[model samples]
Target: MFFHLNLLSVFRGVLYSDNSQGQDGVDIYGPIDGGTAFSGIQCKNRKLNLIDGSPNRISNIDVQSEIEKAKKFKPALKKLIIATSLPKDKAIEEFVRLQSMEHVKVGLFTIQICFWEFFERKIPEFETVYNWYVKNEGFHRIKQLSVTFKDGSVEMTYHPKFQKTVDRYIIPPTNNTAPDINPYTSSLANLLQSDINKMMQPGYNSIFRSTLLLSNTIDWEQLCWLELLVSNIGQAVVEDYKIELSLEGFFEKAEPERGNVLFNPDFHNDIKGYRNSNSHLYIEPRKKILVQGDSFVTGSFYIQPAIAVEAEIKLNWKLLSRDFTDSGTLIVKIVPQYHVIINRHEVLDSTDVREEISYSLIKRKGTYNIGSIDYHDKESDYPVS
Candidate 1:
C-alpha cells in the first residue's frame, strides 16, 4: 500500500575482531579476509514524457511480462518502487490493465507506482484510476504520490485513519519549563547586529545606498504608482463599475501626496515603538453618535450598507430564512459628495441608484442607521390584521 524509493549506493567495509591468546581456549578471531559489500538502489534523474513516442500500442502480453518480471524481482527486493516517465493517459492505462488481473489483486502485490509530469505536460489521467482504487481498496492503504519537475515537486501524502486514531490517544512528555518571554526582542537584536556589521563594512553602505537609491528613484516610484493605480482601478471597475470613476480620480490626485502623508513625522510617531512597549497610542478620538429609526427601516439600512461594502447587492427577500414575495418598491441611492474630476472636467453630480421591488420589509418597527444615512420610508403601509 505504501512505497518509498531511495537512491542506490554500494559501500564496502571490513568486519574486524580483537585477536588475543586466551589461557582456556584457542586464539580469538581476527579481521576477516573478505569484506562485505552492500548495494542500495536509488532512483535519480527522473523525467516525464507526456507525448507517446512510439506508434505501437502496449499489448496485454507486455503488461503480463512486466508483472512477471516484478514477481521474479520480488524475492530479492526488500522494497519495490516503480516509476514511469510516461504521460498520464499511458500511465493510467497501464495501471488499470496491470491491476485488472486476479493474481495482481492478491495481497502479495505491494509495489507502488510513482508518476511525474514536468512542465508543459498534460494533466494526469489518474482520476478514474484513483476513483476505482478508492472504491475497491479504500484510501487507508494508498501512500505516496508525487508530481514533480526539475525545479519543483508536489507530493500527496495520505494519512492512515487507523494511525491517526492511535496517535490521538498517545500521550507525549510535557516540559514544565517556562518558554522564552522576549523571543521577538532577541530576534530583533540579532538582526540589528547583522545590519550593523553590514553597515560598518567598507563599500557595503555605498552599494546598499546605491541599490536603495535605484529602488526609491522617482521613475521607479512613478511606475509603481501607475501599476497600483491601473490594478486598483481595473479591480474596482470589475467589482463595482459605479465606483470606478471615483477611484480613478482619487488615485490621480492622491498618489503624489501619498509619500508626504505616509512618511510624515507625526505618522511615524503614532505607530513607532507601540509593538515593543506595552502602551496604547490613541491617534484619534472615537466619537459615539446616536441614530433612531423603526425596525423595518433600520434593518434595510443596516443590511444594504453591509452588503454594499463587500460589493454585493442582495436582490432576494427572505422571511425566516425562506424566500417570500412582498409587493413594494425600495430605492437605495449612493451619492458621493466630493468633487470627482473625469476627463479634465469636475463632475459634482453623480448618484448610484439601486432599486429593489419586494414585499418583505413591511409592518416592522425599529430604528436603522448605518454610519451616516438614516433609511426610512413614508410609503410603508402596515398590514391591517
Candidate 2:
C-alpha cells in the first residue's frame, strides 16, 4: 500500500533495507530534494484479536520508541510517519500532534500517525491498492472460489444432446432391392472436433426419405455435473463457512450432483436445507473450516438446458466465512449434441449424384427434428418412390 504513494513526484519511495545498523524503526524511506533531506514511514500492525478477546493498542511508549529510533536514521529525516492498523485513538492523535510540535521546535523530524480510519478514507483515492490490499489481494485473510471439470479445467465443453436410434418398425421399408448405402463421409471431422473440445477443456444414425434420419435426446448429465474447487487462498483460517452457487443462462433445472455433504453437528445444520428453486446450489464443507492455503472440492451438479441448439451456463459463486468473505463467477460452455436430417427424393440412380443432392439439401434448407423422434434404425434397400 505504501508503494501507491510513489505516484507523487514529491517523493520516490524505496524499501529501507540498510538494516546492518538495525532498522532504526523506519520500514520505508524516500529522499526529498536530491537526498538533502529524507522522509520515512514505520508500519505497525495492531489488530484486536476477536477470537482471544485481546486488545491490541499503540501506547505512548510504543510511539516514543519508534520516534527515538527514527532520529538515528541517516540523511537527517525531515518527517516520520507511523502507519498502523490500530483503531483510531483521539488521545494518541493529540499526543502525536504535541510531540510533532516539540520535535519541530528542537529541529527534529515531525511525527504523525495514520490510523485505520486514515487508510479507510484514502481507499477511494487508491482503488487499486485498496482492492489488492483489502478486497481480494495481499497476504492477509481472504477467500477465493473457482470451478473446473473433473479434469481440473476451469472450462467444461460437452454435448448436451445424446443420440437415440429410432425404431425401424415405426417407418418400415417400402422396398428391398439394391443394398442401401451410407451417404455420410468422415474426413478428419473427429480430429477437428477433438481440437474444438480441447479449446475450452481439453456421433450418426439412419435414413427415412432416402436421405438420412437421426435423432438426439437432451442429455442433462452432459450439461451439468460440473466440478467446483473452493480455495482459501488467504493467510488465515476461516470457520463456519458456507458457499452459495447460483446458476444462470440456458438451463431449466439445477441440483447438486450428490455426495460430498459436509455436516456440522455443532451448528445443527446439514447441507440439505440450503437448496432453493432459483437454480442455486449450496454446500457447507466438512467441519466448516477452511484453512490458509487449503481448498475443498464440492460435489458436482447437473442442470438441464433447452433441448438442442447451443448452451452457455454460468456459475456465480459467493463464499461467506466467519472471518472472510468473497465472491466470483465461473463459466461453462456446452455444445448441445444434435443432427440434421435432410429429405431426399429419388432423382438420379447415380450414387454420386444422390449423395450430392443430399449434401446440397442439408446445406440449404434442412429440417430439424428435436426431442423424441420416430426414425427407422435401418435404411431401406431402395429409395421410396
Instruction: State every prediction's TM-score relative to the real structure.
Output: 0.17, 0.39
Candidate 2 root-mean-square deviation in Å: 18.2
- The local distance difference test score of model 1 is 0.24
Q: 309, model 1: CA deviation in Å?
A: 60
Error of 1 at 70 (Å): 2.4
Error of 2 at 219 (Å): 8.8
Candidate 2 lDDT for residue 17: 53
Give one digit per residue, the lDDT tens place, for model 1 in 316-369. 211110111111112222211111111112233333222222211112112333
Candidate 2 weakest lDDT stretch, 10 residues: 356-365
Worst 10 residues of 1 by lDDT: 158-167
